[model samples]
Target: MKSKWPEKLRKGLHAPADALGNLFVESFHYLALFGIGAITAYAAVATFIEMLEKGGISVDDILLLFIYLELGAMVGIYFKTNHMPIRFLLYVAITALTRLLIGDVSHHKAPDVGLLYVCGGILLLAFAILVVRFASYRYPSTRVIDANGKDMDDGKV
Candidate 1:
């Protein structure tokens, strides 16, 4: 005759605890995404307005805007698809490096080994992106989205 009290007690306590933990996590996730999206949007608009006031748009400003756009897109995709694509971040990084290289060359006007390093870094990042794309294409992952738009990655009923 085994006592069923311990099993019942454990189940009674664990279910609500797990549900509360998930609730907190979901709340933080949405709040963080909203804050990031709002800040990125604000920065992009301020940059655009500043460029308008200056009466000219430089390559650097355009690149900055592109970076902000990518950030916002990443956040949006994460919210909708629940998956963030690494390619967007890579694109942002490459664009930022190009902007830096351009700004440096325009100001220095001299050949520098640092420029070679920047170019090498850009090439490496490009290769990494290529690898990621190839792998993703070759081994596509399947996501099961229910009517509620949540990912069903786990095999839980």
Candidate 2:
């Protein structure tokens, strides 16, 4: 019979390296997320201050604030659940495009095909968000667990 000791010995030696590597990488990753969240919050505050100075807020300003909110929420969710919901990203992109379209079209009275293109892009992004949600519902991640650390097999959340 083949000796099982060698395999056990190898695994024991490799475990520390795997664990340390994960710790190193995740530490920096979370640090980066914190930095991004901080910068986003700062920028959002600056934008709000600018709007206050002007004594009025435009639709574009509101949309810009919405973008910042989504970004901040994305970072917060990551810290809370260790998972980033991609729908937040799609929503940000769609909001950005809408802001761009509104700003561009409102400034000039002339009609252009660019409006159509931007609208199409927004529609495509909406469709992508639906697809992501559908896939998440259909084939969910297996990391769902209950209070006792056992996998919950009831249904997708």
Candidate 3:
């Protein structure tokens, strides 16, 4: 007796519409990336112009600009090389947190509360850095090579 499952599977696997759908999906990827890049470029330039018009840029403003620059750079690198350096995100987050803390301190009326928030933000940043370092040390992206040139995944030194 022939099985009904294999007959159905063979018919479904060779469907012509699936191939055409994949082509459209791939084309959309490039269009989306280009749109995102254009938006980011416009924002970065506009921000720089506004900062210049203000006569002087403050540390908080500089930090925010750096965050935007890093974001654009990260997107550029991702498209160029299909890999993202996680450390770049970490740096951006640190800078953003620093900017938030600074802005909070400058504008807030209560010194004690501002100081507490600043300290908390710093502590959180330090902890995140430590976790990233530990993870990298334990499971490095590059394989460890022996004298014989065989790559090893084992973390043992």
Task: Give the per-residue lDDT digits (tens) of candidate 2, residues 1-157.
Answer: 9999999999998999899999999999989999999999999999999999999989999999999999999999999998889999999999999999999988877768988999999999999999999999999887678887776776643
Each candidate's root-mean-square deviation in Å?
A: 3.0, 4.4, 6.4
TM-score of predicted structure 1:
0.89
lDDT of 3: 0.80
Per-candidate TM-scores read 0.89, 0.80, 0.68
- lDDT of candidates 1 onward, in order: 0.93, 0.94, 0.80
Q: Candidate 1 — what's its lDDT?
A: 0.93
Better of 1 and 3 by TM-score: 1
Error of 1 at 134 (Å): 0.5
Model 3 reaches what TM-score against the true structure? Answer: 0.68
- Best-performing candidate as measured by lDDT: 2
Superposed Cα deviation of residue 124, candidate 3 (Å)? 1.9
Candidate with more favorable, higher TM-score: 2 or 3 = 2
Q: lDDT by residue for model 1 over 25-118, one digit each (tens)?
A: 9999999999999999999999999999999988888889989999999999999988889998998899899989988988777968999999
Ranking by lDDT: 2, 1, 3
lDDT of 1 at 53: 100
- Candidate 2 root-mean-square deviation in Å: 4.4
